[model samples]
Target: MAEEWRRETGGRRTSAARERFERIYHTLRDRICLLDYPPDTRLSEEALAEEFGISRTPLRRVLGLLEAQGLLKSVQGVGTIVTDVDLDELAQVYQLRMELAELLGKLSPVMPDEETLALFRAHHKRSLGLIDKPDPRTFARLNMDFLQALLLITGNEPLRDISERLYFQTTRIWLKLTAHMDIAEEVAVFSREIGDILAAVEIGDLEAAGYIRRSHISMSFTRLKKLTI
Candidate 1:
């Protein structure tokens, strides 16, 4: 009985620690995406561990996860730095993202429960209100939230995970891109495309949602085509 109790205790502790690690990873990841931790920003393991009050073991695990996601790079003696966005790499990423997201559309029920439906509707209204704001960051973040809300209703872990990973890669890019954009033009474009997708979702029509998403993505790629990057 004592041996079994010890095993259970250890298991619970491990689970709790894993949850904490994930939370930290997400915190750092979101900051990076929001450009709160901008490109090439160096962070030492010791400093981060101390800041978070976590020991090296758990903190290292969080860093490792970020590195694997291409968000951070660990240098031999210099510690880790947030990776810069590569437009070429981003284009390749989107190719894969498009394919994976289509898989999600096929697998996802998109029939969100009433509570989720209500939540999504609220988020949609919120985005519309924010559309007039001049800050591209606001629009970018809201776009992320709206997409996340849609993915939440998908209930497919692999799809959700890949979608988030790819999305993060482009968040900082969006930040940069927004600076060069006519906010009014971009916001209008996003509003129309996103509004169409959300409307389809609101009615439980994943087919139309997927088509709208595809077209929206194609439009975005075309917009980027003129860039010398």
Candidate 2:
């Protein structure tokens, strides 16, 4: 589809390359989010292009997208480096997230469709099973999936777009702290919070659902603060 779009647009020099660039872009973005490529890590355009079997031209395009997302920066004398989170900004962003989450909860369908509920239940069971599984990455992925699925119940494009941006922007923060996070404790908290919120939604108690969601977000920030300076 990307190739077809590019071809139809008839862009010279770059039409045939959009698909490859997009794939590479998402791969690097996920690595950045998961800390597979840690902050302050230097990204060499030449090395990356070679690694991905692409050329510098398309590689720069991918890097540009990551930079625009605030995940990468080009430095003089050094190479492109992963951008570090500003502490104050992190606090403010997460604070805003609390309210945004509340609003989303209030706005989401009071009774989500059967598919949505089933997905939530699957995530719930998976989250419970991971509590003592000794794999932080797996659990974190499941938690992310659960939250994302729940957020989809809102069916608000603008809201989902903004919320998702904030989500990925801060996701690295949580992923970075997995080393210090208590897996069992984190799992238990997430399970209870998700359970309560879903229960409220099932009963059409949007107000209670919203409150529970806000409180859940607040608790996350509180825990993150404790680990931060």
Candidate 3:
């Protein structure tokens, strides 16, 4: 009876451990995205565990998961540190995002259903509502959500995977650049532009949709460059 009870307790502990790992992993990822854990900052597992009130085992598991996701790196003697922003990588990601976003616009006209349009409208509204909130972090997340919803219309698995990865990296950089820049007007303008793009797609004007999408991304890049200094 004691042996059986011990096995049951072990199983419960394993399940709880997995939950704790996921919780820590997502919290760390959010912090990284928001630039709370700035570039090249050393991350102490023990301190994190203590702060989160979790054990080392779960924290270690979370660290390994983050490392695999390219958000953290562990050196032989330097411990785990948040990875620095790579300009080259950021450029590549921005280029890829532009391409994929244009492709998504091209495909939007052929979605052949109202559900896709409805999703786009919903996200666009939410993004527009966030324009006056004065929080860069919230604005960034809503912007990303709007873009992801637009891309989901394509239903291309590989494209979705690539876009998500690129989106996260671009969002990280964007959040950093906008930390001190108040561009609420620009965000509101872009929100209106997105609505126009969706309207064009609904009318089956693929070429117009593509042009507007590309223009929006290009303008955003130009604006971001001006603020990075």
Per-residue alpha-carbon lDDT of model 1 for 1-229, expressed as tens digits? Answer: 1222233334455656656766787789878888888899998788888988989987876777788779899887888999998877877887776676665557755576788777667766766676666467787777777777767556666677777788787767767676666777777777777677767877878766766776776667667655535
Give candidate 2's error at residue 115 in angstroms. 2.5
Which regions of candidate 3 deviate over 4 angstroms? 1-27, 44-69, 105-115, 204-211
- Candidate 2 Cα deviation (angstroms), residue 73: 1.5
Estimate the lDDT of model 3. 0.70
Top candidate on TM-score is 1
Worst-scoring 10-residue span by lDDT in model 2: 1-10
How far off is residue 168 in model 1, in Å? 1.1
lDDT of 3 by residue, 1-229 (tens): 1222233244455656556655676678778877889878899978998999988875776677667557789998999989866776766667777787777645533553688778878867876777866567777666766766666556555565566656666677777677566668767877877788788768866567767877787777777777764
TM per model?
0.87, 0.79, 0.70
> Against the unseen true structure, what C-alpha lDDT does each candidate score?
0.73, 0.74, 0.70
Any residue pairs clashing in model 3, and if so which? none
Cα RMSD for predicted model 1: 5.4
State the number of backbone clashes in model 2: 0
- Tell me the spans in candidate 1 whose CA falls farther than 4 Å from its real position: 1-15, 108-110
Q: Which prediction has more favorable lDDT, 2 or 3? A: 2
